[model samples]
Each structure stands twice: as C-alpha cells, then as structure tokens.
Target: MFYICDERGVWPRRQRRPSDCSSQLVRVKLIGEVLAPFFLVAAFEPIGLWFTAPIAFAIYLSFLKHQHRTILYSIYFAFTANLLILYWSGAYVGVLPWVALSLLQTLYFLPIGILARFSNNIPLLISSILVMEEVKARFPFGGFSWTRIAFSQINSPLASIVTIGGVLSLSFATLLLAYLLITKKKSVAYVLLSLSILPSLVSVIQDSSEEKSLRFTAIQGGTPSKGLDFNSRAMGVLNMHLAESYRSVKGDEDLIIWPENAIDIDPLENAIVREKINELIKRTNVPLLGGAVLSEGPTNAAMLFREDGSIGSIYIKRYLTPFGEYIPLRSISEFLSPYAERVDDFEPGQVLKIHSVSGSKVSSIICFEIINDGIVREAARSSGLMVVHTNSATFAGTAEGDQQLAITRLRALEHNREIVSISTTGPSAIITARGEVIKSLKDGEIGSLSGEALILLKISISDYLGGFAPVITLIISLLWALSSMRRKDNN
Candidate 1:
C-alpha cells in the first residue's frame, strides 16, 4: 500500500528495490495495475499501434503509485516514459516539448491511486476505479478523460452494447468482461453477458428505420513540415488544406469535413479567408464543416459554410487544451507554449455544439474533447450524429495515437452515431454506428474519401433518456459491496 506522496514539498523517497516483486501487496498492486491498461491497449491491436504504450503506462503507474516517492517521481516517470519512447524512435520534434506536459498530466492519477487504498477486493477495486474516474472527470481544470476503457471496446462486437449502456455503463460492462475473463467466472457470467448484448439486439430489432446515406467528403491538408516552427507556417498549412480540399471536392459529395484546425484564419476576422470560404462552398455546392479559430488563436473551433450563400453556423470549442491552449502559469506558459502571433488565446465555448448540415444536426467535440466520454454522451443526447475534429500533429510517430482513434470508433457505437473523425495528420474516415472503421486514411496522408453512405440520425434512445441508469447502477453495485464490507467491519 506504500505510494509516492508530497505534501507541498516533502518528497517521499523511492522503494528499496525497483526489481523485487515478492511482496503480496506489491503483487496485488502490480496485477491490478497492469490489468486495466493491458486490456485497454490490447483493444487497439487491430490498428497498427504496438500494445506497449498503454501497457507501459499502466506498469509505470503501478510502481510509481505504490512507491515511497516524490510527486516529482510521478511527473518524471510520466515525462521519461513518453520521452524515452520518442527519443528512442529518433523523433526529434513535437514530443520533446511535451515531456513536461505529460508529467503535469500524471497528477490526475494521484487521487485515483489514493482512492484505490480503500478498495480491498475486486468489486471494490472496480467501483473505486469508476468513482475515481468520475472524480477526475470533474475538477482540476476539467479532468482529462483520455484513455477511457470504453474506447478499447471498439474492435470487439460488444461495441453495439454501448447503444443501451452508454459510456458510464461501459466501465461496468468492460470490467465485468475483464473480471470474468481474467478470473474464469463462467457460472453466473451468462447474466452479465446477456445484459451486455441483449439491449443492443433489441435496439437493432425494434428500430428498423432505414438509414439514409449522405454523400460526404473529408480532407486533411498536411502541415508544411513536421519539424521547425509551426507558428510562422500557419498560412502555409492553411493553403495546403485548401488546396487539398479543392482536389477532394466532388459534385456528388453532400458534406465535406476538415480537421479541427483546418481554417488557418480567425473566423471573426480575415476578409480574404471569409471570401474564399464562401467561394469554396459556392463552387463545391456542398456544405463544408471545417475547423478554425473562432475569436483568435488557441480557441479551436469549427464552422459550417453551407453552399446556400448563408454564413454557416460557427461552433466554438467548449473544451480547450489546458497547457497547450492557454498555459497553466502565465510565467511558465509564456516561456513554454506561447500563443502564436496574431493568436490571443483560445476562447472556450459554453457547451458542446452541433450544427445542421445536409438535413442532419451533427454533434461535435473538438480534438482533446473526444476522449471525454461524458462530453460525448452530452452531445449524443441531442444530436443526429457525433463527430470529432482533431489535430494530432504533435504525437510520437509510433501508432500510439491510433489507440485513441480506436476509442473514437468505440464511442460511435456507444451513442449509435456515425462518428466522422477528421484529424490534421490523418486517420480521417467514416466510422459506422457499430464502432467499426468503414474506411480511413492513415496518418499524414492527403486527399479525401467521399461517398454516399447512409447515416441514421435518431430522435433519442432509451439510454439517452435514462442516462442516470448507468450512474444508478454504479451506485447500487458500490453500495452493495460497501454494505457487505460494513457488515464484515461490524462482524
């Protein structure tokens, strides 16, 4: 149960043995530690990514969590594990600057580790993880919900279960699956299994509304270069995407989607860019939902420039990247990740935005927001479909990023919405409501995929109307276990 802790500045020292794995406490910590990340990462194996990054993260968190160590240890481990991979790959670019950023992010796990101390058994452990996740999701500048377990379910046929269960429900479903599989619990596992598949089956059966495909085109214009200054080359990046769009635009394509940072110009200003957008829509004769800065700079946003000669609705991004968008400390951020010239700061939108396009209201959670299951749920509650606009120009070239993309696909299934994720680097495609990638372009690949595919926009689902079911189920399970624990406590 030992772990790293720092009250203000009192740093805990490391364990006596880094290699030793004999202690029961350590073994429990180790197994529980690696289990979550292992299955999660394994879920991404279908994609090109090696299953190590997520697994390594889980192992590091295990040792770091229970070691008598410094807060700096957690930070350093987070930074080092990430940087070590990047440095080994000879990727001398965006990741180096992110070393510190990763360290800062590791703090999110600190409280989760602390909460795990109360979990004496498997059920409690699972409940504790869910509760800790819920807590981490709320505060400290809106918790980073990256790497949710639900995302890993994309490749599995179980993804359809998301239609009825939702994201919160996924944790329970995933855990039960993990626990039963890991422990070989075949006796009563049938009920849990049935619970998972039965709803999705009924949903597909009861809902036979035929899907209507909308012809759409999505494009990702490559950056000027991977290395060197990204700030000065903004115009170059913008032009490249515009040019790519021109090549990709087809008469039959009804909708065109660009990555989160597609528009290099500020939506409010930039007369020439404005004129070009109108012209592009007019020429293509189709709606283009492209990413841009709304007010200025870091405020990443999306705009729907329709072909009908109207100012397309603007969607300002609600969740902004904490350190990247606006820095933590003014002093540190100024020196570290400064706002690019002509870019003030990313303005935050109040909530998730869904704009009407081609007779469908598509809910969007820009870039980093895609990882947040809660945000996706919020948007899925009131939209025809969900889309994620992302920019992964800053990542370890290894397929590690694809793991996140897999999560996006799983999320599509969760809400039963067609998730069209258009990213800056690549992996842009149309993910079906079943969480399978129908078609996708790899990283840094140029061009677009346009075709008429049926997209179902629903009024609402049973899960949507009863979101509290997931939360309530979690509460009942936790209370049952805790009550049992209390009985044992009295006994």
Candidate 2:
C-alpha cells in the first residue's frame, strides 16, 4: 500500500493526482454550495427556521475550508444568499439596483474567503466574519447590516447571548456552534448550546419587575396602496393615522406612536395638517410621537407633539436609506431607477434625541436606522424604552417587513429593553425585553396595539461593550494571522 502526500495531506498511490482530487471535491459538493443559501434564507424572515442558519453556515464553511477556489465559491454563495434575503429591495425599484446592491455586498465576502484559503483556524474564520460585518456596516453609503447572522438567531437560544455581547457576540456564538458541529464535537456543542440559554433561564427566574410602565398605543394605519406610490396619497395616509388614533385612543394613554411616513405631508408647513395633528393631540390629551417628513431640509423625523400641539424634542433620522430616501451619484442612480430623480436628498441629523414622555425617557430610530448597531445601542443607553417607526409600504407584500420585525426583536433582546415596532401598512408589534412579541398587528392590517410597556433602566452588558467586540475580534484575528504566517515562513 504505497502512499503519497501533497498540499491536501496524504492519500494512496491510486489517488495521488491532487488536481483530480480538487476536481472531485468541486464536483461532489457543488450542489451543497449552491443549496446552502436556501437554508440560510430559510433561517430569516417569512420562512423563519432559525435553527437552519447553523446548518447552512456549516455547509458554506465546509466549502470554504476544503474547496480549491474558495474566493469564487464564496462569491457565488454570498450573491445567492443576498439575492434571496434582499429580494424586497427590488419590489418597487427596478432589478438593476437590486442586483447591483447584492453584487456590491457580495464583494465583502471575498476577504473572508481569501483568509479561509490561507488557514482553517477556527478563531480566524469566526473573527473574519465579524470584521467583514463591521466593515460592510460603515462603508458604501453607511453599510447594510440587515443580513447579519445574529438577526437570524432572534428566536434561537443563542439570542440571549446578545445581552452579554450585542449582535457580534450572538453572531460569534452561532458560528462557533456551526464549527463545533462540523468538527463533530457533540459534547462541547451540547454544552455550549445549553449554556447559551442560561441567560434567558436566569431572566425568567428573576423578579423581572419594571421600575415604571407607560400606557401607549402603536398605530399601524394601512396605506391605500402598496409600492413607491403608496404615499402618493400623502394626505390620505396622514388622515388614516389620525383616524386610527382617534378610534383607538381611550384618553388614558401617555403616548400614541405612529409608523414612519405616517405624516408624509409637512405638518409644520401645512397649516391644515398641523391643526389636524394639534386637534388629535388636544382631543386625546396624549403626547403624540409620530414619523413626519418636514419640508425644511426635507428631513425624515420622529416628532413629539405636546398636548398643546407644540412640537417637542425631534429625532431627525441619523441614518437614511441610501437609494431610497436619498439618491447617491444622481445621474447614475437616475439611470438605474427612473424614480430616483424625484428623490430629494434629506439631511442627516447630527444629534441623538431622546424624548421625555410622561416622566419616562423614550428613544427611537426611524425605519432603516434600526439596523445601525451604534445608533441602536446609543438609543438604548439613553432611554428606558425604545420605539422603532418604519414604513414598509414600499416593500409591502414582501418579506421585508417580516425581516425588519426580526431585526427589531433582536435589538430588543440585545439591550434588554422593550421595543414598540410600528410599521405602516402592517405588522406592528410590541416586543418584550426578552425578544418575545406579546402583541402584534398583521401585515396590511389597519389597527392599533395598546399596551403597558415597561420602562426598563437596567443596561445589558452588550450595551456597554458590544460596539467594541468587532474591533477587538479583528485585531486578534490579524495578530493570529501574522503569527501563523511567521511559523509557515520559519518552516
């Protein structure tokens, strides 16, 4: 039994052709690489099977480890997965922007694949993912963090880990689980799996009492139509929200919240709209916190209206949707989206505003801003309760709304704070600190959710350290890579 050795390790004389072995590897697992994204897609949104995420990554990482063309395979995997996860990006906009965005995002995976090809170090692989996520989140028009692995684990036992290390920690644990399972470390995997749920278990056993609570109403006023034109009937949208608030308010509520774009008309500029809003506040005698698009700066803001209809603290959205709210590269964007020319560039807010409503400090992030880790974490730290106002009318009839809800749930868990997620055109939910959806209105449903939201002041460990986790991971990974290369050179 003569033996041979090559870059892939030793094999019998009959199997000594490493090229043939590489070809065999590609041919045998090509289907797995192609289908791996489907499992990952299933782990998120409408088809939410949170457990499938690990299985999908195990398959994906296996290919990166053993395949000859890791970079190419990684591109294929990332592009396919992104296309599925971000299909809603093209719901109203044309396919050009959708495909273009997906391709651009896919490039972020190249570095991970390149690193994987260099070494199969577990910590290196895991840290590379965190680094990639962190970079993509800040680059190319304020990065998209929607497709993060932690968002997919909102329902899994791993979600509780987010409280300790934020989304990065949860993502680390998820990948660690996949690696452990792939390496057939069942006992260790089981131990990790059990330990992941310990936070939730402890939370349940504890008093879980609230220092204070607010009686609030979240209005999900359905749009007349769905698409880019959903708000074409801008005044109608505002009226619907007012109608819902009037119908839902029992006069005892401390605050009434509305989804983003609830007031497409500039309430300040339009006297009629202003009077109507003031009338709503006066009648309900409740502080009105709603999403409004102001004519000045053409800003997208969450406005807090006092009982006298005077505007209080306003949170102008810090992070705006790249192609949606504002068009970048005007001529090029117009070429891709015919409606791009109509988009007026909204100015980004420079300050973080936390509204004081009925003795409770309330924080909020508008629609797309919820995906921004720093903004979300800072908002959680500044206030006792958080509210997310989103308008999914553009991406209505798609999985986008559900996916945003999933992310919202994770944010709730990450900071251990109750979040009231209000979405125009449906799926408004009041999520608990533990990421449980206690009450919700379905998609396209015109209704309101009135509940007592606990004002929790306890800050999670993630709130304090989550922002630093990725940077730390990247530094450690680089140090390890350098050490590994030194050893290779010495040999």
Candidate 3:
C-alpha cells in the first residue's frame, strides 16, 4: 500500500521480486524456529506464564508448515525446550544424563516435522503430535510425560478441558487453537475459544453435589541436606517427619500422610523405626499413611498404620523412576552418571492398592508416578480422594519441585478429587478438586498442612476416556495419512 521510488522519481510501486519474497519468508521462519522454545519454556515453571503457550505454539507451527529442513528445525526446537524444562533431571547428578535424556525425547518430534512437510491437514498434524506424546510416554523404559504441553496450561482457561478427556484433550485443543491462529482462521478460532470456556462453567455446576469430607494432615519434613545424599541420614529424615507430626497433629484429624522416602530405613526390618511409627499412630489416634522402602522386595511402598497401632493396607509404587530407582542399562548408565552405581534397582509393584480410611477410599501414587497417565487415571476411577507421596530433595534447589507441584494440580482437575501432595523438601500442597491450592508449604520448609478434603466419588469423563484418547488420535492420524496419499495418486 505504499509507493516505491528508486532511481526513477515519482514512479508507481512495483511488486516485490519472487526472490525477495522468498528470502523474507525464510527469515520469518528462522526467527520463529529460534524464539518459540523460549516462550514455551516461559509457559512452564518456574516462570509459569501460561498465556505464552499459545503464542509459542503458533510460531512453532507456522515454521513447520510448508517449511524445508523441517526435521532439523523441529529437533532444534524440541531439544531447546526440553533442555530447559528438564534441567532439574541432572541437577544433582551431572550434565551427561540431562543432555542424553533431552536428546532421546527430541527424537520423537522428527515424525511430526516429516508429516508437516508432506501435508498441511491441521487434524493430521495435531493427531501426530498426540500419538507421539503417547508413544514417548510408554516406550524406552517407561516414557517421561513431564514434557507434555498440557502440563503447562494448568493456570489457563484451557486447563478445564482436561476434565473432559484428561491431558490429551487439552493438548489437542491447544494445538488446534495455535494452528487456527497462524492460519488466520479467526472465525473458527473464536468459536473454539468460546467452547473452551464451557468446561469451566460445567465444572462449577458439578461442584454443587454434596460429598463426604475428611480431616487430613500432610507433613513436609525438610531434608537434612539437598542433593543425592539427602537420604544418606535415613534416621534423620524419619525423625524430622515424626517431630513435625507430633508438633502439628491436633488429635482430631481422620488421616495423616507423609512424603515419599520419609522413612528411608526399612520400617518392617527395623524394629526401632516400626515401633516408633506405631507409637505415633497410637498417640495420634488417627490412621497414618507413610512411604517406606522395604528391604525384603526392595520395593518403594506406602504403608498404612491404623489407629490401633497396626499396619493395614499397603500400596507399592507401580511406576519407579529410571536411573533414580532402577538402572536400565547398568553399564551405559553408570558411565553417564557417577551416582548410578550407588542406585539400587528397586522392584516395581504389579498391583494398585486403594486404602480405606474412615469409610473413604483413598488412592496413593508415589513420586514419578504422577506423570503416568494410565496409572493416575486408573487410580482416580476407583477412589474419592488422591494422595501423592513425593520426595523432591534430590533436585531441591532447582525448579523440579515447582514443576511437579504444577503437574499435581493438573491431576486434581483431571479427576474431580481433592489431593494431598506431600514432598520431603518440598512444595507440598493440599489441592481441591478444582485444582486450587487450599494450603501449601514452601520448598525446604519443615511444616505440616492440615485441611478438610472432600471425598467426591463422582468419576470425571477424563478418568473414563483418558487412556482411549491417544489410541483414537493415532487412528485418526493414520486414516488422514492414507487419504492424503490416495489424493496424491489420483492427481
């Protein structure tokens, strides 16, 4: 809309040369590819700028559409984003493990890039991303789901979509909105935007249902020190939890929970520790659920202590952290991490256990299990309340604790249940079914959070359909790919 006058004065404006347009397009793509990851990282903790997620994905998808060298650029974007998001993975260990883990995850993005290069079908691109996320979460020694985009949207209105189809649904909606934004499909984008708010409205209507409530206390006993040696003084960790429990419990709570690895010593094998826990339960006159490492099976488990000073239901951790709980490739892993050799391969539990406390069913998942979609969904299906036992002391000074707390909040929303998420050196919190934090303790603080938690037996649509969403997305992606190939052949 402007006149161009070069050597010839007062001349009419002319169209830009094809080469000039091509060069300008290339620059735009490069800029987007380089800057998108930073914005994506900002969307997650410890920055937690949730509104930036759509902007980040819009730029990323624009770069992907009809772009050459798509695979390389996609890898660059993924690696940069993952490296920042998972920096805590090697905070206590070293750089080798962190870099290696990030690279492994980055490989999953190659297919998305390749698919984008061939087809501009928005559904195909969105489905491919969801399928890759699901595959990455289950393969290569139980995949890490911490990098999923939906985890960063907890503070956004889009988060409410999780109640309909868990994290996968929210992720799909986010990508769709991003694609629409970049493609200038403003009309449809506005419609989807309006629909996204509907879930929140529905959630408010659902909350009016009357439900049973229980008084609970979550103890966050600060670790003796930060790093890999946080549990070196096993008794010190146990004593700190005991001291906090005694000082905080008001003798009126129905249940008390402790963080994972709080009792690093085997309470079953150690008579002293077992007797101490029993005495605490007896004195409190309340049911106690605490995590322990059993020496017999070398299993990481949550043991329930009854008010009568006897052990009750025991829920073993089904998902164990790789390289932390068990070494996958002993020789290679040891080379990558010096502390790898010191890590004992703990046995994974085959069963999911729900504890019954004062007529309410409670589900418990320990530490890294929070990221496993299937485990959390299955647990939420049967229980009214959720308890997360975690120990964030290993990556204490880093953003790991805050990131994990954010993930826990998302889970609370995914299932309509109140949660008690406790960590050893931690960002412990008592979260409501709406993903609101009723009470919390700061990192590296020795304290306890006591609150009233509702036992809502209502199962969310997400709890029922979360596991199936990925399979459905994968099927849709395959069908789209086949249809595109047929269209090309007909042409």
Best by TM-score: 3
TM-score of model 3 vs. true structure? 0.91
What are the per-residue Cα lDDT tens digits for candidate 3 across 1-491?
22233342221233333332445545565677688999899989999998777788877766665345678878988999999999999887889999999999899999988977776555566678888878888888998888898899899877888887778777776776776666666665785687588777777766667468889889998878889998899999999999999999999999999989998899878999989898898888988999999996799999898998778898999899988899999999998888899999999999999999999899999999999988998889889899999999999989999999999999999898889999998899999988999899998888999998988887777766667866664675568547756665211
The residue pairs that clash in candidate 2, if any, are none
Q: Assess the local accuracy of residue 49 in candidate 3 as a C-alpha lDDT between 0 and 100.
A: 92
Descending-lDDT candidate ranking:
2, 3, 1
> What is candidate 1's lDDT per residue for 199-315, written digit by digit as tens?
666776656574566677888777876533443576777788778888888766778888877776674688877777777788888788888876554567788777875666777
Kindly list the per-residue Cα lDDT of model 2 for residues 256-319, writing each as its tens digit. 9998999989988899999999999988899899999998998999999998889998999999
RMSD to native for every prediction?
Answer: 7.2, 3.9, 4.9
TM-score of each: 0.76, 0.91, 0.91
lDDT of each: 0.61, 0.84, 0.84
- lDDT assessment of candidate 2: 0.84
Model 3 scores worst on lDDT over the 10 consecutive residues at 8-17
